[model samples]
Each structure stands twice: as structure tokens, then as C-alpha cells.
Target chain A: MRFRGRALKAYVVASLAVLALHYIVPYTVLHRAEGFTLYAFWSILAAAWVVATVVFVSWGWLER
Target chain B: MVRTIAEFLATLVIYIAVGTAIALVSRRFGVKTSSEYFVAGYRLGGFLSSMTYAATTYSAFMMIGLVGFAYATGVGALGFELAYLLATLALLTVLAPRVWLMARERGWVSPTEMLSDLYGTNALGHLVAVLYLVALIPYISAQMIGVGSIFEGLGAGFGTGIAVAAALSLTWVVVAGVWSVASTDAYQGLWMITAALTYVLWVTLFLVPSAGLDIGRVAEAITKAGVSGLGGFWTPTTFTAFTVPWLFFAVTNPQVVQRVFMPANERSLKRLIQYFAIYAIIYTLIVTLVGLTARALTEVGVLGYISNRDLVTPTLLLAAHPALASFIYVSIVAAAISTSNSIVLSVTSSFVRDLYERRAREVRPRRSITLANSVVASLVATSAVVAFLRPGFVVEMSVLSSVILLPLAPVTIAGWVSEGVRGVARYSSLVAVVVGVSTALYSAAAYGPKKAFITTWFGVPISVWVLALSTLIVVAGLLLSRVKPHVGR
Candidate 1:
């Protein structure tokens, strides 16, 4: 249960990265992508989340 | 009308019978101690832990509220909900392991107890418990509202719906405590996912064809709706205001936070997060599509006008084939009862373990269980009454709950990473809770949901203001403190 310093550091970085992507992708890209089906747009957005999850999980595994 | 009512009743009966069976089977697992009763003795396997977490977290909001929101607001709704999911995953990655370790090592049953033990102050725990009850009661009530509105939309009386939801919620928790709640939650979780998939398929295969709605044409129409509704509803400020508090939901909300203590081991914890993330992604996508499809149908004149956003799903269901509608109806009921029972169990545990037990000495396990059962019953009854009053929209009620609970985020973060700032953190949390709750109440009262943010300072909503102010105060307290970190017990 000890808080591994490396894990905490990696988590912060991944969180910031994910959050920044979340903000940028929706506002910049998807918001302006006219005529894209909701499914198509959401699939891209879900991909962003998948990438974020991968980053988080990889870092967690490495730290562990 | 009679046939619809009969279908609804039959679905409800089947759901109750299944849930009761799960609870009865779970009860066979023995509950000799308060900890065992409240947390399944921390022995939940990965599947049970994951399903319970998913069920408790998803709630009726996904099918009913989120569908309505997406129908009304378009892709912005997806962004807001996705942001929550991402933030939750991030938080779980960093915090869950630490929380699990502390709980296992310290024998902490509630997050409040963990905070109190971390800060070496019982008052902090009491304050947290009180704030949790204040915030969560409305949220619990919102579930009842979800159920009531569904039934009302399907031609039954709202009062009957609320009563039925409350009775089912009370039955599961009162029967087997956390064991029952978790088992029933797992059962309900499966029901929810299956129902959601079926719904999406029905909408795509049957509804889309029947309506003659082209996906590309619907997308074009959505894009043409201009800034207010579909295309540009998520102005940055509005999005931040709505999403900031929810980003911390996994840690701040006691029901999910307490689940951090329930996994059997580290592997179980990891599996729980993995399972929840998959469930959340699939469910969010399905519900969002349901909303978009509903909107498209309305645009094509296939579905009638829906003036109230919350009625989007229910209205569609009412017009759907009876059997399909009945299954989805049962799923929504499962969502409501699963969430309500989990909240009841968690709140009851907080009352007994954090508040009552902290004050009294030498209370026996039997007495504690009896007291918890009484509290659960009372809380459910009170929340059902509140639901009968029908205070506000489900999503708005949930956001208000998150806003009031936002102050706990900084305290939790500081507790983990900081040293020797216990007094500062404690007092800052108290101040923040007071100010945040007051501001939220005043805003809600003065303007209601639509205009609630009209009176914002510097163009930011009161929720963001509360979060910023609370974090600032906590930072200031940390800067002022000079004491060394207290060694862990």
C-alpha cells in the first residue's frame, strides 16, 4: 500500500497528458468537424481515452 | 394502458425476485462483525468488486439523465461524461493502490476514518461524515426520481414508482448489508449492460429503419443546430464548470471511495479498475448513441416532440415494442435500485462506523447492525419523500451533490502528499464546505439550473469558484503550517 514515488510522479504526468488531450481534442478538432456522425466523432473521442488508459496502465505497471 | 402497466409490473416482479435471490445467497457468507457486514470482509473477488463498482457508479443517470442530456446538448454531453471517465481512471491509478494499502494496514472501514486517522483528528471524520450525508441524500433521492419519472412516463403514477423503488432499495440492503448490496449490484450491472446493448441494437436495426433516418443526414442536422444546442453548446467555461467537480468523483464520493477498501488484494484492485473502465466506456457510448438516435428521430418527425429533456428515453420506450420496452424498463429500475442500495449501505456505514461508533464505547456488533439497519430504513424513507416532492432535474441534482462534496478533494489530496498540515487541512475543509454549500444553495435558489451560472464571478460558475477558493485556502493553510509530519500509527 505504500505510495511509490515513481508511480505517483508517473500518474501526475499521465493525468495531465490525458486531461490536456481531453480538452484539446473536443474543443479544437471534434467541435469543428462538421457533418461527422455522432458515432464517428465519439469513436475518435473514445480512442483518445483508450490511449490515455494505456499510458496510465503502462506507467502503473512499470512503477509496480 | 393496462397492457403497458402489466408489462411494467411483470418486469418489476422479475427484477425484485432476482435481486432478492442474490441477496439471500450472499447472506449465507456470514457477517459476524460490523466490518464484514459493511464491506464484505474485504474479500470480494475481482468480478464482484468490479461489478459492484460499475453498478454503484453508473446509476440511472446513464440511461435516463445522460440520454436526455445528449439529446439536448449533443456531443458536449459526450465530452463532459468522457472527461469524467478519464479523470476517474487517472485518479484510480494514483490513489486506489495507496488507499487499499492504508485500509488494509490500518483497518480503516470508511474513507472518513482513513482521513481522520491520517490527520490524527476525530473531528475531521465527523465533519466529513456530516458533509457526505448532506450531499448524498439528494443524490440518493435523485435515483428514486429517476425510477418515478420512468414509471410516470410509462403511464404509471409517480408515487407508485417512488414507493416501489424505495421498497426494493430498502429490501436488498436491509437483508444482507454490503454482501447483499454487492451481489445485487453485480447482478444489476450485468442486466444494465445487456439491456443497453439490446437497446442500441433495437435503435439501430428497428427504430432507424422505421423512422427512415439517415445517419449522415442526422449528423448534418445536428451540425446545423448552431451554437446553443448541438454544435457548440460546450463553451469552455460551461464545460469546466460542469466537469471539474465530477473529475474528482471517484475519490470524493464516499460510495465509490469506500469501494477502494473492498477489493481482496492488489490484483483485485487492478482488475476492478480494468473492469469498471471497460463497462463505463461501453455503457457511456451506448447511452450517448441512444440519445443521439432519439434526437435524430425527433428531427425526422418520427418521434414526437420532447419538451422535457429527461423524458427522451422514457417517451421513446413507451412508443417501443412492448417486450423490448419492458426489458429496458426493468434495466432502468435495476440501475436505480442498485445505486440507491449502494448509497444507503455506504451512508449507513459512515453513520455507524465514523459518527456513532466514534462517540460511543463498548457497543456490541449486534447492536451496531441493528442501528445501521434503522438508519438505512430512515434514510431511504426520507429520500423517497424527497423524490416524491420532485425537487429538480436528475443531472442538476447530481451536480449539486458533487459541488458540495468538492471541498473534500483538496483535503484528500493533501492528506496523501503533504506533511504536517493536518490543522490547516482540517480547518480549510470546514471553511470550504461552509462557503461552497452556501454559494451552491444560493445559486440554485436564486436562478434555478438554467440561470444558475448567470451570477458567476469573473465569468466562472459558482462551482468552479468554490473549487478554486477551497484549493487556495488549503494551499494557504499548508504554507502557514510549520509542524513536522506526524508519524503513521
Candidate 2:
């Protein structure tokens, strides 16, 4: 954590790779979504968001 | 033309009244300095913050955009409403209060202030600010287009329509600036709520029931119109479509961040969060039911519709409550102005505060800078009219604006908490943004004119994809830094 500078550079590099993937992905791959999967994804994100909120709060108050 | 005239005049009277009342209230409060004008002098608390937050968050996008979206999509549209509810609450609990504390200490009037100060990298701050400027113009332009549409819908004279609306909007904005916007929001918020509820009730109760409209007819018509009519909400793969856009609407949205900052104290924020969630859910359900109802009415030949799918709600209400329709008619105007006023005001203020004042020496006064800011708003407004010549809907443009902001959110959140990633965190955020935007740009054109993207089980909008990739970028940076953490620092 103390030497986050190197870590940031690595992240910058990887993010660029993802951007490349975005471009490489074929348009034909995407299709009309079935609604259930979309709902399920939202359900999961809702859970993750709740968990993240808990983790974020605890991270601040516990050490303080 | 007659319709446009009526709509324009209707908008003018309601919007100017709302604006004047807000300005008058702010004037009476006697805010003596500029600090109070922008951030409510950093002393806003409880009721003022709560009401203003309600007004600020419920933009024209919500009243018109979501209604149109649901009219086209179905129950699946709930993904957006629910996502924003959860996201706003979570943001209020986490980032917002901290931003307040930090701003209280450091006096951050605009978001760019936080970006630069927290990262201690003014270049990164400026880069992000520049993106914000680019992204925000489209969003503001979306608001102006909304105003223009309301005029076109009502049949006002073109010259008077545009000039009157713009003039009234400008008058209220100058009268009290942010204070005026917030104050008018309080009043407009009330009218908009009352009118929305009234129309929802009347449309569902008398209009359809008397005509014997049913669900079967509604489904038949939607099936006939093709996939877009469903907006992919009913697709078996709807969940895939839901995840990214939902989250983006909630947590990653700048407008939501703006709401988090408006509340006066921790208590007010908590109350407002609870307040907004309940209100949002109730409104969503009511409006969706009405949409389904309208579908049946349209199918059964009970009501004749017009050019825009958006006019369904208004038309339904008019059919049901011909006597009381004027109330809701003006109420829709209230809804549009409530949103447009704040958006135009906030965007101009950001340009003024972040771009102009930030550059000015302390003694330069930036007198010309203030006028330049309004001129910039007008110029941007002109460009929106040019863009409108292309035939895209206001909601579509608004969604595009949201998609654009997705790339910037990750870097911002990372920088905000000082995420302890230091150099890696900042760099990752920046990288994520670049990657995200590029992905989105490529994806944007592919998604077609009406929709943005589609995936079967886990559709990620180009915007959401940007945020997700950005997050991955941050994580990878963090992990990589573990191996060699000495370079940037």
C-alpha cells in the first residue's frame, strides 16, 4: 500500500488492454437480451453494492 | 402550431413563476456572499437540503425520459429506478458525507476541486475536468432540447417560444444563481409531485376502466412494434441488460453525486435518502402501471396518440380528466423546468467556478468571465438545436450523456477516498477512464441509433463496460504495485 505508485502504472496498462478487447469484440456477438439475465445481474450488483458499502464503512471507522 | 403555442405559454408561466418565487426566497434570505450562492454557504441543513435534494435529483430525465422508457420497455424498466435508489443511498452513506467533511475543511465548491486536491496532481485534475466539461454539455443540451420539445408539443410561436423560455430561464438563474435554482426546486418539487400523482391516479382509474382496456390487447400491440418497443426489458436475457446500466445510474452518476452534496447534515442526508427511495419506488410503480394501462387503451382504440411515444402520459391524463387536465398540463411543465433549470444552472456554474475562476488571479475579479459563461451556455444551447436536426429523442441523447460519464466515475471514486493505492490508484483511474471511453465510443456506434448495446445474459452498456474495465484497471494496478511499488512515488 505504501508504494502504490507502481501499482497504479500496472492498472493503467491493464485498463488499456481491456479497451483493446472492447474494440476487438465482434458486433455480431451481441444479441437481444433475455430479460431474466439482466434482472439477475442487477440483483447481484445490488448485493455487491451493499457489501461494498459495509466494507468501505468498516475500513474507515475501525482503524480510526 | 396552436398546440406548440399553448405548450410554450404554459411552460413560460409556470417556469417563470417557479423561478421568481425561488429567487425571491433567496433574496429575502439575504445571502451576502458568493460562497453561499454556490454551496449554500456550506451551511445548508435539514429541510432546505432535503427538499432541494428531491428537486435536484428528479431531473427532466426522470419525469419524461423514464416515463417514455417504461412506456416502451415494460416492468424491466424498474432496474433503472431500483438501481438509482440503492446507489444514491449507498453514495450518501459513504462518499457524500466524506465529501462534505473534506469540502468543509478544504472548501471544494466544484468536483474538479476535489479531483486536484485529493490526488495532488493538478494535471490529472484538469484532464478529468476537461472530460467533465465535454460530457456535461450534452447533458445540459439534453435539458434545453427537452424545453424545446415541450414548446413544439404545445404549438407556440417559434420565436416567442424559444426566446420566452430562454429568457425566463435566464432571469431566474441570474436572480439568485444556485440559490434561485434550489429555491425554485423546492416549489417546483411540490407541484411536480402533486401533478404526477394526480395524473397517475386519473389515468389508471377513469380513463381505462370505463373503456374496458385489458392486458392482452397491450401485449399484442407491443409485440407488433418489434423488439425496441420492449426496450429489451422482457427479453429472457433482461438480467444481462440490467447489471451495468443499473449500477451506472445509481453509483456512478454525477447528478446523484450532486444530490449527495446538497443535503445540510448527516441526518438530513439519511432522511432524504429514505425519502427519495420510497418516493422513487412509489412513482415508478404508479407510472409503470399507467404505462401498461395506456398500452391497453391504445390497443382498444380508446385514445388516439401522436408523434412522440412520450406524449402517452399527458394524452392519457387529458382523456381522463378533461376538466382538471390543465393542472397536470402545467404540472408537466413544472416537471420539465424543475429539471432543466437546475441542469443549465449547474453546468454553467461548473464552467464558471472550475474553468474560469480557477484560472483567474485573486484580484482580476473575473467580471468578463461571468458574462462569457452565459455566452458559452447560449452557444452550447445553439449547438443542441443543430444536433436536434438529426432526429434523436431527448431521452436518447440524455442516455448517451450518461453513457459518456461512466468512464470517468472509477477514477473519481478512487481519488476521492485516497484509496491508499496512491500512484497506482490514480494511474489506474486515469487508465480506466481512457480505456472505458474508447470501448464506449466503439460500442456506441455499433449499438444502433435507438439503443446502446445488447448482450444475452449479461449485457454491459458501453458506459457500464467503461466503469467495469476501469475498476479492473484499478485492481490490476494495485496488484502490480505490490510487486514494485517505488516508481511513481
TM-score to native of every candidate shown? 0.92, 0.76
Q: Give a tens-digit lDDT track for model 1, residues B29-133.
A: 888777888888888888999999999998888888899988888777877788888888877876677677678778888778877886677777888888877
Model 2, residue B460: what's the lDDT?
Answer: 38
CAPRI-style quality class for the chain A–B interface of candidate 2: incorrect
lDDT of 2 by residue, B1-489 (tens): 344345435555665765687677787654444455556666555555656666666666565666665566654564546555565554454455566556667766656555666655556556655665555555555555665665555554333434544555565566665666667767777777776787776765666567774444445544444321324355534433443554445344444455555556555654555555445555555555566556556545666643476776556644543335556555555555555555555455455566666776761434633553464458445535643552454345455555566766666665555434455655666677678766665665666424564532154344446667877886686666552222221
Q: How many backbone clashes does candidate 2 have?
A: 33
Q: Provide the TM-score of chain B versus the true chain B for each model in turn.
A: 0.93, 0.82
Q: What share of the true interface contacts does each candidate keep?
A: 0.36, 0.06
- Candidate 1 achieves a global lDDT of 0.78
lDDT of 2 by residue, A8-57 (tens): 34434543443232222211222223323333343444444445443433
Model 2 alpha-carbon drift over 4 Å, by segment: A1-64, B1-15, B31-34, B158-160, B213-233, B236-239, B304-308, B317-323, B363-395, B419-421, B446-449, B455-461, B479-489
For model 2 the local lDDT of residue B148 reads 61
